[model samples]
Target: MISSRSFVAISFAVVPFVFFACAKGSSLPGGGGGAGGEGGDEWSGPAQSSSSSGGMGGSGGMGASSSSASSGASSSSGGSGGGGSGPLPIVLLRIGDGVTTLSSAAAPVSLEWRLTDGSATPGAPGTTSMPQVISGSNYQLTLSGTASSEGHLSLSANGKYVFLAGYAADVGTLNVSTQIVSRVVGRVDASGNVNTSTLLTGAFNGSNVRGATSSDGTSIWVSGNSTTTGGIHYTTLGSSSPTQILSNPLNTRCVHASGGQLYATSGAGTFVNVFTVGAGLPTSTGQTATSLPGLPTLGASPYGFVVLDLSAAIAGPDTLYVADDRSPANGGGIQKWTFDGASWSLAATWNDGTAGVRGLAATPWGGGVRIVATTAENNENRVLTLFDDGSAFPEIVIATIAPLNTVFRGVAFAPQ
Candidate 1:
């Protein structure tokens, strides 16, 4: 059973207030680059045929729908997608962990990657595997190794490089030689050929990793237990040595950067830690920090969290979405949160049935929102649940997606 003590200990371990004060004390430095051929065998020549020709409207499924549509419509649509000006790139996250096992012995963990068509329907409706063809173009990548734990894959606004975190004892980057096609144009079929390579290494920070991307995709935020100091720290894009943003010796599982702000979860605390970013990003070293209201009471610790700032939505600027995976045995369920332009607070709470939520990702679908989350282990299948802004949770299986030996860890989509 999940214990209250363990929950409380985990939540408060990485207190944001402690880190805000700590962030003021000292500073750390770091830099990053890839080791393969100078940009290696990246797509060099002219543009290949367009990968996505149909457009965003073609890719369907509640997950890829835009957030502007009505929630009722969003909840029922199986293959509807949010319209986009052009094709978008899809980012896949491989989540797993590593350890130096005994010589002649094998590693204890496995590598897994979760694939999401940048705008939903990177494949076809009712199809377990990604569609092989799209607008007379082919898509492929080189992939290797087993995903163990917490890692990241970040996509740019223009979709050039998909930054991957926590892999092969270091961070890696998947540089698409050409523009990524949207699901509407074509779907990604699993050939298990996605390329794998490292970008940064050396005493990397964090454990049970959590990461966030900047609006421009120029920067990212990662929070977790640090390998170098064993304390929780936040790292930015392109930096190997993190700026030790927080270190109360607590273990953090998730980190997010949005709307010029940073948020983190201790998975064992009552408060959602917050940080304010300056012009530099992951580089800013967080000049300021604050706490969000409506965190679980001490007994009901909030473990996993996600944040989305829909400033672009015609709705309002101060809107934020957060989820709390609670164990009644430990005290919570599927919870919701919101933030005005200035302060943050809770919105609603609901039970996601038997299995609780572990991770969350949001995509805009025609005036509404589509969310994907993982449930605690069930039978043979690890439950992947989908939620529309106004409805109950639904099970949407991503069966037969590639890189066989690898498991799906996290999901991310390119901005429309």
Candidate 2:
């Protein structure tokens, strides 16, 4: 469980760019709209709702332990249903996040998710997608729907889940900028089941949320880029909507929580920012984020990322992996950097193929790391797995999994 913090709510610089990289070539798997994927202050932000009757109202205190059911996106979006009796597989894919069209009808669909593996449980295609297994919490959330495209995902600090910031597709269009944009936070488990999820809706007045991350498994911080009221939205499991905790940095895209430290990609400057996590996401709205030092000026295209620690006794993370959706020529591809307590250095760059890689996840391998990634948006997009070792590559391609109309978005892989 996460403890609450006080926020003062500072004015975050509005992201002038509504990153809808639907440009000519590389873009988000061809669907809804998302471009590049920012925060501030003491505990001052949006006030919580006062509803008491929970089912799906706004105050969040109620949780319904219902069986996982089939949503409209079941046929097209990814899903979670396997009974994790034995060792669970790695990789979680966020299929349709509602905004994208799956059926020929171009109808809005619910959020969908799928759990498979890079090689162990091998799927024709993959996502959250990776081969290496990580250990985190003990619960999960199962999803089903047709999300044209959705945001990226992250595993909890302990590793058992893929934290997700999703819209409730059963109701309205989650175009955070122009609509009420109902969002939900999830803990996708090993059996591909989200045991307890957080619902952020009812009175949310934010915009363009794209990524989610958690320190423990109870609370989540969602990041996005909006021209107006968009920044860091927070909520606990089973809650309704969320409170905007900080608003300083602009165009906050993807977020990750590692080793008690909170890190995120900033669209405003195409760089990464770090926040000191005190139990949950920083509560003081006045809290300021520091730019991650030692990067080679990532000029946009920086999507989802992962930070891994080689040793717990070491105090901080030593290895970092960042996903840039631009072509190698334009600084696109997967970047592997190593950190020495004080600074980071270019360890290597992987951009052999797959146009440009977007969202990525990694696990410790032999002497290196095993990585899984989703290619930059393309009609023939793919889920790929390559190894630092303990894996393979021609880059094993996990493709034929989803229905033809579905586009795979965010992915998470955590093993316990």
Candidate 3:
């Protein structure tokens, strides 16, 4: 339900923070990291492994196949992963307001993470049983408002961090706006451990929470809702204050701060855009921004995306994977675009029936890439894994989450 003028909103369960629900069959649409060791223990689940031993192949265009293949495939993940016996990959996910981890692999899909706390509400809860300041901060947002909570991989001045961006809303009626009670950001280690007390004091119902840093991980550019900018902002380590950065064509959908560059999804006009930052990503605000060349001007609702560069040079990435939530006719699905010496081209589209995708993550495999994504805006949303070798293959279901009344949002690679 998008209009030329404004992005529509829908209240979810007791949490009235407007849920960013993209149309299942409709379309256009629209983040990163922080300190390390700030997260404490609070995880429980089976880890998925993505080894490149054997997989299936098919012929032709982007049409997908669900038929099973032999063991040894791939899963969704992060970092410049190539050869085998590498770092055990970690997949970061935003299930509700809280975040969790999945050990990624190439074979049988990982099992769905379910609530063992025994709350009557299994999926999205009306009143959260999670802590309140939350109480202990060691718990997951299991029985709570289910919405698009964006998670990103970032770095502190010292180490890598996973940024969990989300907010808690006061009890209210569905479809009716309510007061936003808490805007919070959780920091974690690569293993999904809570690192610090979450905090965010603005009106932003953060769609993407990320930060840009040089190899040093300081003087950064951050993303999310701000009281002043309403889009991307700038912040640093050891402090909670954020300065307004980008103002025009404001985007709160999702953002990525990497390699002295800022990439974000700016809605229907352009699928993805970028902003330039000073080297070292200096602590100051004030920077120049612009829409990227060759991206579609309309008909794409992109959520999570990965801009990857495997070349030896530090130039702009050559591979781009955008999570578009529109139907196949309207350009919905996981759109794979490749950059030549110049312009970008649509390489492929992966889908699950008519349903579209929202959150996403990827890493290099045996000369190919392993991708994991969440289905969106339908009664049958899911968290899935795919092994892409430029061929047609069956999509592996990690979990059919709609039955839990829950929806998955932003996803990222944990610090490797």
Clashes of each: 49, 54, 30
In angstroms, the error of model 1 at 15 is 42
Per-residue CA lDDT of model 2 for 1-416, tens digit only, reads 10112111112111111111110000000000123222211111320000000011011111111012110100001111111122123443534432455331212222333223322343312222221111243222222222222357677776655666544433222332334445556565544454334655642244444667776667777776444445566777666657666565645667776656667766555344333333434754544656556775445456667776664556567667777666544545556666777887756445433245666766553344545567665322555444443111112223223344344556555434
The total of clashing pairs for model 2 equals: 54
For model 3, the superposed segments whose C-alpha errors exceed 4 Å read 1-88, 92-131, 135-159, 168-182, 196-198, 203-222, 225-228, 268-283, 311-315, 378-380, 392-403
lDDT of 3: 0.40
Among all candidates shown, the one with the greatest TM-score: 2
lDDT of 1 by residue, 54-115 (tens): 12212112221112211111111122122322332333332212222111111112222222
- Candidate models: Cα lDDT each: 0.30, 0.44, 0.40
Candidate 3 lDDT over residue span 16-85, tens digit each: 1212221100000012111110001010111011223122222111223121211112221122112322
lDDT of 3 at 132: 28
TM-score of each: 0.51, 0.63, 0.61
The per-residue C-alpha lDDT of model 2 at residue 234 equals 71
Cα distance off (Å), candidate 3, residue 348: 1.4
Distance from true position, residue 146, model 1, in Å? 11
